[model samples]
Target: MNAPDIIDFGERLLVPHVIKGETQISAEVEHFSRATQETVMTPKLDLDALVWRRHEVGPAFDTPLAEIIDFLDAVSEALDYDKNSYLQEAMEQNARIGTLGARILENCYRDIATFFTREAATAEAVGSFGSLEALDGWHRQSIRGAETDIRAFPPRMVHILAGNAPVVPPITIVRAALSKGLHLLKMPSNDMFTATALLRTMADVGPDHPVTRSFSAAYWRGGDEAVEGHIFRSQYYDKLAVWGGDAAVRHAMKYAAPGFEIISFDPKVSIGLIGKEAHESEESLANVAERAAADVLAFNQDACACARFQFVEGDDEQIDAFCSALQSEMGKNTRYGDGPNGPVPPQEAVEELDMLDMLAPLYHVYGKPNGGGMVIRSSEPVGFNPSGKIINVVQVNELSEALPHVTVATQTVGVYPQSRMGGLRDALSSSGVQRIVRLGNHIGGAFGGLPHDGGWPLHRMMHWVSAEV
Candidate 1:
């Protein structure tokens, strides 16, 4: 892979440029961060120019929906990991700016194309609007006394992308194309290159295409009031699609007014619920352990969907055995993780475990901080966040007893014994859990037209306009 002009100076990293629509914005503005002590040089953003004019927005909205799909298909071809230059650049620079390892990051980048498909694109429109015809043009519907024609129009949006998952860039790009919206992506500090790399790939496919010209990706510090104060108003952008991080979402909320709406994918937690049936036999216990391990190993527990907390129904001896089995199973290979011994837990988590170990009978720690997965069987929930293949298992009298821990911040709950889900799903949903899945199947499809972070974002990204005659 031929690397870009990005320079790493041990202390300071220089990102070569930013993407402004089909144009490449060079290093014109230098930003210094006192927090990270890193200086970033990118093109100066013309805050006024970021907003699309009435005439420019019209061309994008009028572009045939099929044409936009074709453009996205071409983009999918450009993301091929074996041949795409942009992804190659991403693979090279990801280590300095990303959280995942080289092998895991490559696996994610390769799957980028799957996120863009006719089925996936149209499905989001259908799922959001009941029919694809709503996005193509006005669809007339018969009413009791009056006939109404309704259509979905794209809104001008600013996508604040979180870099936790590498595939987010393509997801945002496909959604923007499908909705036919004007997008200005504010790149996060962790993984800044992928989004700009994607826009550059689109420009290569069709530089003058309306879709390509309707997109831009750049970077500024997240809370820079000077830049955000000007661009976040309703006059400049209609929607703010903020992803990940509590601070990012809170800062974006300050700009949300009556006309400007914030579509937030806030930070969330996921947990696993195991039934006593798992202990029906040694084999049943082993199977449950394997499934629980896979959920914890997802992105080494960095992803929101990865199970960090677990509630189990078993006696003290049985629960202790399950923890040991779970830690052992996590050492084996899974789709999201490879080799033996998973990543080590974060330092703070390890310190908390160490402090808890002194409590003896009240708390038990399985597996060490060195790696290979760790489980903290606690009488109550731990305070520190769980990460790096760590799972906190709390024994519960019944699965529903764990309901109090489930809140609006809970994104997914993986329950054991498929039949148990039928009993717990309603209560789980009412308690603010958006998704409930079979114990071993916590990871699901990422395509649109699906429930995400509690709402349908594609539907939120559009302006539902109606006319009556």
Candidate 2:
């Protein structure tokens, strides 16, 4: 059979053992492929089996934390993409459905194992809750007149995952296992097979384990009312851990009834700020430019944490030099598995830059518009979003001038000089930026146990119940 036929024949969803009787209905999995700029259909799902019933909550909630960690560690060991047939199949299927290329996907799959280690799982539990004891059972505390016992109880949740990055599935899986929640992953079209591949790997390691049985992965059209309208009810799920574009979030909001809450990871943008100190010497300028390149080129600028607009403090001459150097640095940095030519920008965006280049002095366009990576410097922020390894370097008199441009939609800001961050952090926080990091550190520096989008997600994934005695 051909690739498409094989994909179509495989049933993508897992039918939990708790589910009894036959399938009431079935549907084809469908989604738009951003990679091919077309619609792609893959496999079928037993829709009735995807729904969670209150009485059918998996034993994961009551399973001891240490055992849960052990299960997760075993899952980590089983995710070796080279050895596992499920992941190897996922690698092949995802290459066709996902936006990322094969090599990048392999790297992401390899890194997924790192997050599932016992050390990492324990850290997640501790970071989310002050004490790991909270997840085990109610811990006692005293008030002025009364004593209270509080526990972080798992809630039945549905994670509407995004496909921009392939690592999201494993991230959600880790969070769900740590929180001991009943999870139903609504896989995105761009990359549907990964979550199912992960769960299948876990099943191999622990077939009868609670954590293995706790997860269910499926893909339905994002706004399919017949499917969503039924499972999105408060009776079926307590929380919806949503992540996607604006339309996806809006669709989920409609289902946010009295009891079913939405923990939204809204679509966001990131920016960079460079202080005047960057121009104190040629070496300094070179160093900052290289750092700036790392931020823009990360995940080929597809990540929300990747900086799109950069605010620099310097004269037009100084800025031009930095822009030229930044463009050169972007071409050299391919650590994120970018092609030799780098990411190709959209033809429309390149055309806009071409027009801007004709009006020189007002706008400086450095590097080729091709996948070689380009830097566009303007006195004001550009009108469009930058991607395809493109970075918009905006001129600023001082780093503080960039503060007004920051908004709630801004997720991260990478500052050039370490000293400048202390002064701007308060204003950046007030303006709604969730994370602030030094230049070149956007990829590894801003993440881990930290508040994401504006909140601690692990905390939000569970219900903190208390009883006064």
Give the best candidate by TM-score. 1
Clashes of 2: 0
- The TM-scores, one per candidate, come to 0.92, 0.91
Residue-level lDDT of model 2, residues 1-469, one tens digit each, is 1111133334332211112211111324445655564555544655667766778866687889888989889888887767777676677667776667777777777777887888777877788777677799788899787899988888889999998887788888888988887888887877767877777777667777888777787667788888888888888789998898888899889888899999999988999999999999999999998888888876678878888999999998899999999888887735563644567888999898999899888997998866778999999998999888888999999888888899999998998799888998999999999999998888765124667788888999898899998
Look at candidate 2 and tell me the lDDT of residue 268.
Answer: 89
Q: How much does each candidate deviate from the true structure in C-alpha RMSD?
A: 2.6, 3.8
| lDDT of all predictions | 0.79, 0.79
Evaluated at residue 360, the lDDT of candidate 1 is 82
Q: 281, model 1: CA deviation in Å?
A: 3.3
Q: Which candidate comes out best when scored by lDDT?
A: 1
